[model samples]
Every structure is written in structure tokens, then in C-alpha cells.
Target: MTDYKLGRDYARQQDQNDPLKTYRNQFHIPKDEDGEDAVYMTGNSLGLQPKITATYVNEELESWAKLGVEGHVEGKHPWLHYHEFLTDTMADIVGAKPSEVVVMNTLTANLHFMMVSFYQPTKERYKILIESDAFPSDKYAVESQLRHHGFDDQEGLILWQPREGEELLRYEDLEAILEDQGEHIALVLIGGVNYYTGQFFNLKRITDLGHKYGCMVGFDCAHGAGNVPLNLHQSGADFAVWCTYKYLNSGPGSLAGCFVHERHGNSPELNRFTGWWSHNKKTRFNMRGAFDMLPGAEGWQLSNPPILSMAAIRASLDVFKDVGFEILVQKSKKLTGYFEFLLKDLGEDVIRIITPENPEERGCQLSIQVKNADKTLHDKLTKSGVISDWREPDVIRCAPTPLYNTFEDVYELVERLKKILNG
Candidate 1:
């Protein structure tokens, strides 16, 4: 590991040496009281807007205005097949084949859609497994799924919780749960990265354990899609879903993405909800044509998508393409580690980090547990020009996004936090 140092000069030096530092200019960083860029660190919540997003979005508006209804066939980026353009790039982000990936509805909507196909529960085996601390949206969706199938929501759900006095979920505990109740589990759905703790699960290991118990395995990768490399295909998960708004830097509430392993994609036997878009494009408009479902993840779509939202995604993804994902990951590790190092210097008496310390086991986010602190601390930090977010109770979620965040940003954040705590 490279030796780290304290002080503002060290941070500036690191920024000067950073090859990706120039990328910070491409984003619209929120302004401070002095009209300068704030020490923004909430990419995990919603990424900053890329400078080109407006340009890209405007292109669609112009096409719609000029081409009118013909935009479906004649406009730029043709609305008829617009979603197809995002397929390859999105697949690359989540490490799946184009056939296995599709950009569609919002996150929870896609989760319910995928569950309709993957979470089939028989009388003997009709339970779903998830981490006890999954995002609230995920918990609600799965509970509804369980209730929808005439199962007791609480009785049909199994929580793989952490050990007493521990914050991170242990793989051993999950293995034990599968050993005992895997026979009754119809589905194993988990967050690829825990939103609160920032622990990145071993996707392949979870899938293997679930499959060993004859369960359909899947993941909610809302935080992992653009933050980390999720080899969804090799992980052997039956399906996965994620949003584009956070780390992907797509505009707020942009369409989500879905991944069905190639094994399931080509299998026409799977039960799924479908619509006109799900029909084969060759005869989609025939109206009287037989329902020949388009093979793969695209078959799960239920309606035509909004092109304006997609344009924003395309704009953000283009920036990711320019920087290359692997390089971004490398920068992310270093930036996050530097932020961790600084936090450690603040002393355990003052703060604690709930996220995993290992770079390989977590993304850029580090959940800080400031001792005896409350939402008031978070408010102070925000008032002082640090754009970090607060979770319930006492944790602060600050993420140094590699695409644009600089070492100086991390340094200044800690300095500001220190000042606020002392004040």
C-alpha cells in the first residue's frame, strides 16, 4: 500500500498526479455559498449531472418536434428501437452479454417483474431469503411478492442477519441458513452491495449456495451496476436488476436495467409478464400475428419506454466509456482508501466506519458512525459545504465517486467534518 500523509498539500499533490482529475470538470458540482464547487460526496445517492446530459436530452426533444410521429422510424436515435442502443453499454457495466441485459422500468418495478418469473413458490418450498438490512424498497417489494402468492409475508420471508454486535453479514451465517432452510426457500434475493454498510457480497458464492439448495438466485444491484464490476453471468444468478440514477449518473428516475443469465434468456419456457414490445419486432405491428416472444431479457418488458430519460442515460454512459470502467475502479479504490486513511486519523473515540475496510469487498462508499452524533452533525456538514448524506440514527454516507471526485475533495471533506465536530 502507498503510504498516505495528512494536510491539504498532500491532497493537492495526489490530485495533480491523478490522470482522471480532469474528468471532474465534466460534471456539474453543486455550488457553495461563495459560488465555488462544494465538497460533494454523495454519488451513491445520486450522481452529479454530466455536462453533456442536457445536450443529449435536447437532441431527443428536437427530433420529436421535427419528426413528430415519424420519430419512431425516421428521427435521430429512432424511438422504435431506442432501448436497443443502451443494451451493449449497460451489459458491459454489469458484466453480462447483450442478450442477457435490457434497460427497462424503474428499480422496484423491474424487481417485481423479475420475481414474477424467478420467484415461483411451490407449496413445499415457498420462502424468500434476503439480508436483514436490505434497502427499504427491496424489502417492500419482496414482502408484497410473498403476500401476492397467498403466503404470510413474515412467515414466507427469511432474513440472513449479522451476528450479535456485528454490522456486516457473515457468509457462514448465510451458508448455515441455506443448509437449514434452503429446501423451503424458493428464491435468494440480495443486494450486491449493502446500501447502509457498503459491504459487497460475493455474488457467485451466494448464487452457488442458493443453487446448491435448489433455489432461484438473484440480486438487487442498484448500488453495484456502475460502482463495481458485477459479473452477473459468471455469478450464475438467475436474474438481477439495478437503477441508472445513482452511480450510473443517469438522470433521476431513469429506466432501470435487468439481467437474465443467457441460460434462462434463450429458454422460451420461462413464465413472464409481456406486452407489445415483448413481441418479436419483425411482426410487432401486425396486430393479428401470433405471440412469438422475443428471446432473452427484452421479453420481460411491458411497455414502450421514455426516450428522454434514455437520452440522459446515454449521455452519462458516454462519459463512462471515455474514462473506461477498469481505470475508474482503480481510481475509486485509491480515492476511497485515502478517505478511509484520513478518517482513521480522526480517532476511534470520535468516529467509526461501518463499511468493510477491504477495497475488494466494498465500493467507494464509507458509512461513518460518529460517536454520540445525530442528524444534527449531518446538517452541520451540509451547512459547511460538504454534500454528504445522513442515514437514520447516526451514520453518515459519504462516497467519493471515481468518475469525478478528487483527492482534494476527500481531504476537504474530512477537514470540514473535523471543524464541524469541534464547533
Candidate 2:
């Protein structure tokens, strides 16, 4: 909405004015056959690697080689408390207290772990609610949870689907579902940002509505974490989980994050799966002390962390810290807005964007639905030095990630698409 113009010069000017432009050098942008930078628009799927990631990972390797088992306590950034290294910055990224957030298992694994304590179901309130178009992993996880608890998966799972002929979900629809069946719903788990439509949900509103009906609320912030200002603590949900690879710029398949509201930090009554890492740190090495769980999100740790993955996370977070999240978000809105503007100029009849147009309603990603297009169009774009994501059927997801993607990248992408369409 910044009165975006219709030329490559405009994109270059915006990039020149971008304060976060230099930060792009900190990442290793992929290149095309001609050695030019590829327009990477899939940060929502897997973020680009930080240039310093190798250095950080190597340091851990050196520590392991030099200190052996002593590395647990003696290495630089000691393995004994490696996960703690990420706590503060990660807390700031997701807008949660350090004690409430922890970097641990994979996304789905963390979701299941969180559900073990938060999704306790009785005979009556056993149903779980999720978006109808939720990531397949989440759907599978919830269905398994229902089956494990002796409930009929098909009957117990409630989907908050968009109305016919619509793409974005409505908050009113969610409220109606909760109002009509809230009594039977034990948990309400939603993706913080819908992956396909890129619609950022109102977390606080959802949490309030779910809590009002006596349902435990949580969010799978896999797509929201670094892409948007989640403000998880302010959302007042019981818990949330996210993977660090997407948007977080941690290495692919790296550690994920979990957040348990501070209210449940020391709730002894809550049942959780605990292990050695969850025990009191002071006596953790004693090996004979009773299982006195650590308070807050730390108590959920099931085992020691992978230091290599933590190192990669540390590298990426350092970049986020130096740049400051606010500046990145500011750039994100402008970058995506410009992308939207360019796409809209392509003619609404020729292209459709399913992602919310409101700047506050989405992250950097725009899910484009091209008219009379298929995967071959996406293939052509790739051959034209654009790397993007193709959803099944017809949609293409492109995220102009603020940390690295530029206005020129967005502009060039549309040009390639326009060329292909015209040809």
C-alpha cells in the first residue's frame, strides 16, 4: 500500500533504501546456473543458511575433539547447558519469558509432548479441535492422540473449516464451533499462521474463546515464529510449539521450540513425560536424587540436546539479535506489500492471492493461485532462476523473507511469471 510502482528501478530503489539490506550478506543465498543469485521465496518452508553457521558448528566440533566428555562442563558454551544459550533470544523472538520457552525436540514431537500434559481428556471432554487445512503432521498427531485415548478419531476431531468458495478462515466460524461443541472439546490447537493461505490468526482472540469454553488452547507456531511477532505470552494460550528451521534459519530438520505459559511452570499436578534433563540441574549429576523436576518449560526436556544443532541456532539468532526483530518485521511488511502490489498489477483475473491482504493479517509469504497454471509454470520459474514452493493442485507459496529477500527479488519473480504467462 506504499503506492508501489511498476518497474525494476522502483524495486532497486526500495532495496537501496532498505536498512536491513546489508544483513542479506550474512546468509548464503543460492545461485542459478549462470552464478546469479536465485530469488529464494521459500523461507516459510526452509530458511536460507546463515554464512556463520559453519563456523559455529565447527566450534562445537573443536570442543568435542579437545574436551571429550569434559566438554559437558568445560567446553566453551558448555554442552551441559547448551539449550539455555538459545533461551533468551528465542524468548524475545516469540515474545515469551525465558522460563516459559525452550528449544528442544522436532515440531511434531514437541506437539505430542505438550499434548501429554495439556491434552488430558476425560470421558466427556475428549474431542480436539484443529483447522481443517492444518499441516498434515498436525492432523495425524491429533488423530493418533484421539485413537490412543480410546476415542474415535473421526468423531473426536473437530475441524474449523473455511466456508464454501472461500480460502481464508473466519474467526466467527471458530467461535461458532467452540460455542456449539466447546463442552466436549478438551484441546484447541491451531497453526499460528496457516501455511497454505499465510493467514496469521488472532492468537489472543482464539485463546480467549477457547478458554472461555473450558478448553485448553495451544498453537503450532511453525510458520509464525520468526516470520511474525507472535507475542505468545500475551496470547494467554496454555502452550505453543514451532520448528526452528523455517524462518528461524536454523539448519534444515534442526531443533524445534516449545512454550509453556508461566502459569503452568510449577504445576505439580500436571502430568508430563520427564527425563534426566528435566531433573534439578544442581543435582542432575548426583544420579541418585529423587526426580525433582525443573520448573517452567525446562522441565519438559526429555534428554540432552544436540550441541551441533544448538550451535546452528545460535548462529542464526545472533543475526536476529544484531538486526533487531522490529526492524526485520518492518522490512517484512513493506517487502511483502510490494510483492502483493506487483502481483496485483499482473491483473486479478490472471492471478489470485489467497493470503490475507491486510499487512497485519499475514507474514511475508503470499500464496499465489495463478489462473490456468500448473506445476509446469513453477518449473519454468525455477529454470528462470527463481526458487519457490509449489503446493499440490495449483498454488505457489512465496515468502519475501526480510532477513535476505529484497524488493528486487519480488519484482524479478513477477517479471518471470509474466514472461511465462505471455509466452
Candidate 3:
């Protein structure tokens, strides 16, 4: 078992030595009824707002008030090309070329847009594959796509399921399924990190397997985008989509990011749903001519975005640019490892961690399965000022976000759990 001292004083000492502890002050940590900062462990659901967020957003609001129509091109951060300013940094976060990434629409909306271009199912190979426990939005999106193509959703959808009585998915089982149904599978859409189990799937391995079978692969990276090092370009996926509201620490319902591999950047022949914003910016106002699509992921955009939402995303991306994903990921492994160590010390029978045993196989979030416990156990934790999320059945999800969460946070959380479970 890993060693972690179990006292409050030790927890405080860990925080004092934490490299990323200062980042906590940068966000407006949520408060309780008494106005104390809650433990705030649910960054996986909605991140705390960075204090700078308002400043970034106000700048845009000011430009709009002053310049009106001309703000599109004349504002300090011009509305006409505001999205461009975010490209390089966002690309670095997901490990993609600037041409391959675009920040646009919400998570599910971007998923549908990517499907329009990549999920080209034919009669011979029209089936879609995904994890059985995938987020509901993703399952619905894929099912709807199969229905749109005139195929029976039941027949066209294949599930890569975990072993019976097992909480985690197995790669060997996935390989077996692909070998059996490779010819009929059209696309493989998976969560890069499962929201429920917190399992970070191997993107490159899955991409390689899908391509070997002549299948197009895509990922829903809502839980993985900022929590893990995606390396989307090197993974060689046909497409990917993610929300920024979670680990990226943007505001609630912020703009999502989409990526298309560089090989398909200039393929006008590829099917897509488009809008005026996706038209070639150089000649967008010359509207009387043919529809000239912008290359890469930008071509998939369906409308002009809400600049206010983009402003929040811009503020968060600036933080990411400053920290660098490499440094953040390094911290993540240690912080999460510390969390796992403390939790496991509580004894396996009372608390079972459902996420993968291997640190390399998951992100910072730990989904704890409290034995025979109910929502009341979660309530007690909340009453004690621990801010964790309770998923249905019996799991409580706590994420020690590397950008802000310190080792002390994790240590206190586990100590609190021990007190609760012992009672």
C-alpha cells in the first residue's frame, strides 16, 4: 500500500509544499451557506470560474457597446476572427495542429457535426460501435445517426461491453469483437475518459485497431480533454469532440472543441453541414457565388458562435497556455496517485475504487464505490463541507484537478471518508 499520513496537520503540510496550490486562489471557489469555501471537488462536472474570466468577458461586452456593428472587425479582439486567436493554444491543449482544431458549438452539437463528415456508413458496413456505459448523450447521438441513415438502431449499434461483474472495460475483448465484426462496423465512437468510471481509454491503440479494420474512429473527450494528455493528432482518429466546461475549467456550457486530422483538412468532397461562418472568410460577404467551404474542422461549423461564451473559453485557454499541458499532466499523476493511496488505506471491503488500478490508465478523477452505502453517505460528506458528486447506485466521484487541487485536498477527503464509513 502507498504511504500517506492521515492527520489534518499532515494534510496542511502537503498543501504548503504543493506546486499548484497557488492556482486555487485564481478561481472563485464555491462557498457554503456559512460562506466558507466548500471542498470543491466536482471540477469534473462544472469548474470554478477563474477570477480573470469576468475581465476577459467584459472587454468583449465593452467593445460591443462602443463599436456596435463594426466590432466584428474593429474590436480589440475582433469578433470576425476571434476564434482564430484561440486556435494555437487550444491546439496545444489537445495536441493537434492549428489547422486540425476548431473551437465551436456545444459538445453534443460538435459530435453530430463530426458525424456528418466522418460517419459515412454504407449498406455493407453501416453499424456503429461504442462503450456500453458511454455517456447518454453520445449513445443517443450515434443511435440517431444510424436511424438517419435508414438503418435499424438495434441492429446497427454494437456495444463494447465490460466483462460480466466487472467495472472496467477490457482491450482484449474489444480486439475480439473487432475481429469478429470488423467488416460490418462503420464507426467506433468512444469516450477518451469515461465520465462514470474515470477510465482513460488508449486513444492510439483504439485508433489503430479501428483503422486496421477499415473503420473510421472518433472520440467524445468531454472528460478527457484537459484531464489527460490527448495527443489527438498522433492518435490518428478521424475526428474528436470535447466540452470545455469540465477539466478545461471554462464556465458552464462553454464552447466545445472539434478536431479533424490534417489529412482531411482540404477535402471539400467530404460531406458536411455548414453555415455562413464556415464560408471562406476572405469572400464570405461575396455571397452570391458558390459555397466555398473553409478547410479543416472550421468547415463543420453550423452558425456564428456566441462571443460571450467564447470569451470565457479564451480566458481559460490563457491559463492552459501559461501552465502547459505537459507540466499539468505531470502534476495530475502525482496528485491523483496521492488520492488513490489515501483511499486504499481505508481497507478494500469498505471502499472500492472503480477506476482503473493503473495510474497511466486513468485521469485524476476517482470513482469510489462505498460498500452498501447510499445517497445519505454522500449527504454526510457534503454536510461536512466535502464537495464531491454522487452518481446513481453508490459511486461518489472526486477529482483533484491538477490546475488547482492540492495534495491536502485529497488527504482531507480520504480522512473524511474514513470517519463517515467507520460511523
Candidate 4:
């Protein structure tokens, strides 16, 4: 293990030797009331805007001003094929083939759309499985799917819950649930990373188990996307969806990504909700013959996308392209590990880190339960110019994102928490 120690000087020294320090200047770190850079640690919620985002978005505005309707065919990036430009790069990010990935609607919308084709339930097999404490939106999406199929929403949802007093869900419990009720389940939809607990699930193992039971498996990777090496294709899940606004550094509410394994990319039997955009490019405008479906994930599109939002994604992805996903992940592990080391030094009696200690099972986020602390602790942290989020009851989530957060940021956050708790 690398030698880690206490004190601000040590943190500053680590930042000095950090190879990725140069990229920090590329983002806008928020300023406190007194005008110093705040210890911003919320990349898990929304990533900071890249400095070049404005320039990229402005290009689309300029093109629209000059070309009007002709921008579809005449603009530099060309609106008609704009989504195509992001296909290869995004596919690379999520470890999927070009034909299997698409940038489309927002996260929940894409989840609903994907369920339209993937979550086909029958009279005997109508149950869906998910973690007990899934993100609210994902829980809502799955529950609605059960009700839409004319099943008892409560009875049709199977929760793979944590043991009696523990906080993390066990895969063994999941195995037992499937062992007893596998045949009754039609879909296995899980969050690739548990948003609150910061636990990254074993996607391949979950996929294999679900498939063994004759179920279609999918993941909502909102927390796992830019934070971990998903290798979604290698995992063999039937489908997956993720939002770009978090670790992707894309703007808020930006377009989400969808992936369909190549095995399903060309399958014509699956029922889908389609529109004009889903038509094959060659015949999309022919307007005379039978509806011709595109041969891959591109077939999921229902409308031409908003160009301005896409420009922001393009700009942020260019930053990722320059640094490479591997490089970002390598730095992420080291930075977050150092943060963990320092927190442990504070003594576990006063604080408990609920996020897994093993780096492989989590991303950058650390979910801390300050003994008996509450939201006031989070408010105090914010007032100290440290931007951290607090979940209800007693947990504070701090994510030391590798892209821009420094070792000093982590040090300052703990120092602030220490002062508040000890005082």
C-alpha cells in the first residue's frame, strides 16, 4: 500500500506529484462567498461544466442562425447525422460495439422505451426483480411496468433486500430468491451501482443468473457509467441505460445512452415503439414503400434530437477522448483511495463509511454515516464551503472525482467535518 498520512502539507504534496493535475484547470470549480475555490465533491450528482462547453454549444447556435432548416444538411456537424457522430465514442466509453450503442432520450424515458421491447411478461412469468432501495425513478419505472401489464404491482415486484440489520444486499440472497421464484420472473432490472450505498454489483454474474432462469436482464448504470469500467458488452446483459450528466461532465438533463447487445441488434421479432427516425436512412425519406427498420441500436430513436444538448455532450466527450477512459479510472482509484485512507485515520467510532472498502466494488463516492448525525451536519459542511450531499436520516455522500478534485479538496472536507463534529 502507498504510504498515506495526515496534515494539509501531505495533501498538497500529493497534488503536486499528481500527473492529472493539469486537467483540473479545464473545469470551473465553484467559488465560495469570499471568492476562493470551494471544496466541491459532488460529481456523483452533476459533473462540473467543461470550459469548452460554451464554444461547442455556440457552434450549433451559429449554424442554426445561418442555415435555418438547411442546417440538417448544410451545418458543419449536420443535424441529420448528429447523433451518429457520438455513436463510436460513446460505444467505446461503455465497451459496446458501434452498432449496439445509441445516444437518445433522458434516462427514465429510455428505460421505459427499452422496457417496451425487453420486459415482455406473460400470465405465468410476470414478475420483475430489483434491489429494495433502488433510486426512486428506477423503482417507479419498474413498478409502472408491472401495473401496465395488468399485474398486482406489489405482488409482481421481487426485492432483493439487505439482511436484517445490514445495509448492503447480498448476492447469495439474490440467488436464493431466483432459486425459489426464478421461473416466475420475466425481467431482472438492477442499478449497476447502488446510488446510496455506493456498491457496484457484479453485472456478468447477475446476467448469467437471470439468463439461466429464462429472463431478460438489463441495468441502469447512472452511477456506474463514467465512474467504472462497465464492459457492458462482455457482461452479456440484454440491454443497459445510463445518464451522461453525472460523471460524463455533460450538462444537466443531457441525453442518456442506450445499449442493446449485438445479438439483439438485428433481431426483427422483438416488438419496439418506433417512429420516422427509426426508419433506415436510405429509405427513411422514400415515403413510398413498407417501413424499413434500421439494423441496430439506431432503430430505437423516435425523433431527431435537440442539437444544442448534443453539442455539449460532444464537447465533454472530446475531453474524455484526450485523457482516455483508462487514464481517468486509474487516477480515480488512487484519489479516492487516498481519501479513504484519511477518513479511516479519523477513527471509526465517530464515523462509519458505508461504501465498500474494496475499491473494485465501488467508484469515487464514499457514503459516510456520522454516528448519530443528521442533515444539520450536511448543512454545516456546506456552510464551510465544502460541497457534499446528505441523504435523509444520517448519511453524507462525498465523491472526490478524479477529473477535477484534488487531494487538498479531500483534506479540507475532512478537516471541516472534524471541526464540526469535535466542536
Provide TM-scores for the models. Answer: 0.99, 0.99, 0.97, 0.99
**Which ranking of candidates, highest lDDT first?**
2, 1, 4, 3
Q: In model 2, which residue pairs have backbone atoms overlapping below 3 Å?
A: none
**All models: lDDT?**
0.93, 0.95, 0.89, 0.92
Question: Runs in model 2 with CA error above 4 Å?
Answer: none
Candidate 3 residue-wise lDDT, 68-182, digit = tens: 9899999999998888888999999888999999999999999998989889988899999999999999999999999999999999999999998998999999999999999
RMSD of 2: 0.7
Q: Model 1 off-target regions past 4 Å?
A: none
TM-score-better candidate, 1 vs 3: 1
Stretches of model 3 off by over 4 angstroms after superposition: 1-3
Highest lDDT: give the candidate number: 2
Q: Compared with the true structure, what per-residue lDDT tens digits does model 1 show for residues 47-105? A: 99999999999998999899998999998799999999899888888999999999999
The ten-residue window of minimal lDDT in model 4 covers 282-291
Clashes of each: 0, 0, 0, 0
Off by over 4 Å in 4: none
Q: How does residue 6 of candidate 4 score in lDDT?
A: 83
Model 2: per-residue Cα lDDT at residue 297: 97
